[model samples]
Target chain A: MSTIGYKDWNVDLADVGAIYPFQGWEVAMTIVGVIFWLGWHIFQVKRESAHLEKAKQLGDHDKVHQTLERY
Target chain B: MEGNLNALTTVFTEFYYWVTVVFMFLIHVGFCMYEVAASRSRNHMHTLMKNVMIIPLVTVTFFFFGWWIYWAFPMFPFFGGLDLEAGAANLPWAETMGTNSSDRITGVFWAAFLLFSWTAASIVSGAVIERIRSSALWVHAVLIGSVFWIIDAAWGWHYGGWMVKYLGYHDAYASGVIHAIAGGYALGVIMVLGPRIGKFAPDGTPRDIPPHNPWLLAIGIFLIYTGFWGFYAACNVPIIAPEVIGGQITGITWTATNIYLAPTTLSAITFNFLMSLSGGLMAAYLVSKGDAFWTFSGGLAGIITASAGNDLYHPIQAMLVGAVGVVIVYKLHFWVEKKFKLDDAVGAVAVHGYSGVVGLIIAGFLLWGAPSSPFEGYATITPWGQAVGAVIMFFVLGFLPGWGVSKLQSKLGVLRIPEEVELQGLDYAEHHAYEDAKAEIIEADKAHLAARAT
Candidate 1:
């Protein structure tokens, strides 16, 4: 039993289409992909916000001045 | 040529592989730059030289016996005897191996595979930088580049390989065949070679050894990405007809095929490659908290992770696979470093080895039940098969040879450079000579100026 519906390559090349596994699940795969893309942005935003908040609290005046001057 | 169409196809195929070979040269260029950038100033020359020398050493040794092993050892000592009939045509003295009017594809095809051999060796070179003796590393380079990795390629990557027939192994882009085995080999050598001095504190906490030049390191990886385009192309047959393939495939439709002669398209792989790279980079950035080195390496790791199934995966599946693999590799790298105290100077083992193992297992599930080859009577792709293939690639072929040779070298007291040399840096002698030359030139210039004033 082949996941791709053909257990062997005995068929004519002209007859073969979509050799990739799970041929009918393109829509589901796309949905999962979209979720991952949107989820990444959400995760990144939250992490960045926390990082910035920590940075805002942890900055020392002298170190900040030195960093600014170096830049 | 028998016909104009046949002549054109042969010429096109020859040119295709030739172009890929030229493009793959950039991978070596990138490795040299990356190694030099990672090494401290005191060791830059030695580091560069160590990697630079792998090209010729591996090339010569590969020519001598490596290419023959691929054809001959596809089933030796396991499923059957050596394929002497097939191997004869690829022998070093074989007329086809050299310039012949009838055979145009041999040189370029050999070069394409030779570049992969160099890459396998280079991956190990990166992990053992700074502390390893150049002589010792060269021996490892020859072994991995010519002997061990090629054996894995014969078993898993070849069209008629036993692994593909029996285990349904499907590493379309060498996630395990090249990257995993090389990475595992690096792990074996490093476990015996030990970490650079001061890499760990008395309390056993690992310290960060930042790259000396981050810009060069960045450019180096980018070049590798560029060369990877060629690598992906090289893995393919470019173009072939079903009649020539002589497999179960029927009809006259000509198509591109993976190493296994399975149907795929360059367009499909292109989409998957870019998506997987993006996934790896994004995940690495988040996981490493935007650390530059890890982020860059993550892009590579991502590609390696998705590569096993990239030939058939949807672009989105490719991306997710890459991202997921990077996260696991990143976490595992640090975990192993802490737990085992194994110092991977450039994360070669995790980025290549662990990523490869993960990609193969993932491909097993994602591409499960897919035909491993276009040939009849082959096993279908399965998670169990891929897992076993990963073990054989990573542990059996990769780690064992590396560890055994390194152990012998260690006992002989030749595996690593002297402790003094490591502390002072591998390029100490060269640095002293450079400084002396500068001082002598400055003194002479001063003397000439004084005479002119007088």
Candidate 2:
């Protein structure tokens, strides 16, 4: 038994198709991947919002002036 | 496995695509250098990181679904159901997608498409640099790189796309399909994202946001030029016998064919690509009055403008088309900047979007009455058809999705960074740590000085 569904190299290559492990789980794999992708956006959006909120409270007028001056 | 001829052809095609993928990598390197050099010192690291990360993010996602989209969505929804027959061989779990000795071409061909995905995403990346939230930009990256760009490729760039069969769409080198769509997508994002604070003056005059390093910009453009050559070769089937193509042409002749199995040559494309590049550079220098950024971009614009007809154009016609297109794009860029307060950090919309649209329309007139495909019963290339194709690429597929999604994100308050973050640099800056460190260091130094005095 092979993860790739072939245990021997003697078979004709033309007869072979789907070579990756677990050949029939594409729809499930794709579903998992899509969830990961969508979940990332949700996670990133939340983290970025929190980061920005903390940054806004850092309103030091003097330091801002100094930074602006350098620019 | 099969006949020797079949094996040889398959192996050759696989090698050809593999080589194209390697060469296309330079395009990303060029964009990274170009963006970092253009951005200010404070923003360089962020700019570099933004583009560098696009490689992995796009790669993983493209492997996941982008490849499947090409095969599966060719006739999806509008014309017929998904082409599951074509898509079956490309599923990630399929043997052809991995280390199957029988099928060598599929992996490399998938990579060629993936490289194009990177290019599509990279184009959008350049236009929103220095100011866009990295998280916001990455979202745009995945959307353009893996999803939207691949869909466009299936619709127009594919050999059996509905656009090709029904609309007589002909973008031999993806002048419209990739460049236009990406540029239009960039334009859509930037319109909502706005410009850097100082990009315009109080009087509504547009100020030049110059690249910090002109030399880097120049080298970056040169690298892009090199990669463009690889892109041209990637669009062709290196060699195919007429019999194998199963077309009407009665000949034993072996020929290189465009994506649609129509004949062209490496030599013909080489002449046109360089000539067009030269034309754009010269015209951009004249038009922008030796502006370094426009001059470099002009070379890219020229190639893109001539790309649609390069498969069949006279080399001189390619040059002329490239030259004329640059002049128009250079003008439109400034006009749009002033007319609308949209801050495209780089001239991406003009370079990719305008140049692509113009090229398609020009190709329509130049290659009028020409067959769009080697397959019989397809609509012939025409001006109206080309215009429709351009709009579909730039507006329908490219701009609308980007705008709609970005608008949705904006409504959710997740599109742009907070005003405070934008004002402060988007780097590591904790409020108390630096000040506390400074105080501690000064106090310690004072004690050391007192000890020394005693």
| Among all candidates shown, the one with the greatest TM-score | 1
What residue pairs clash in candidate 2, if any at all? Answer: A18-B94, A18-B95, A19-B95
How well is each residue in A1-71 modelled by candidate 1, as lDDT tens digits?
66677777787878877876688988999999888888889988999899898888857889989999999
TM-score of chain A of 2: 0.86
User: Each candidate's TM vs. the true structure?
Assistant: 0.97, 0.82
Per residue, candidate 2 scores C-alpha lDDT tens digits across B1-454 of: 5999888888788888899889999999999999988887667777889899999999999888889999988777799999998988888787788998877788888888888888999999999887777788788889998888788778887878888878878899988989999999999888887788778899888888789999998889888888889999999999987777775444567778788777777887998899889879877876776677898999999999999878877666677789889999999998898899778888999999999999999888877767777667677777898999999889988898888878877888877776676666554354345668899999999999999999
lDDT of 2 at B89: 88
DockQ of 2: 0.01
Using DockQ, give the best candidate's number. 1
TM-score of only chain B in every candidate structure: 0.99, 0.93
In candidate 2 chain B, where is summed lDDT lowest over 10 consecutive residues?
B425-434
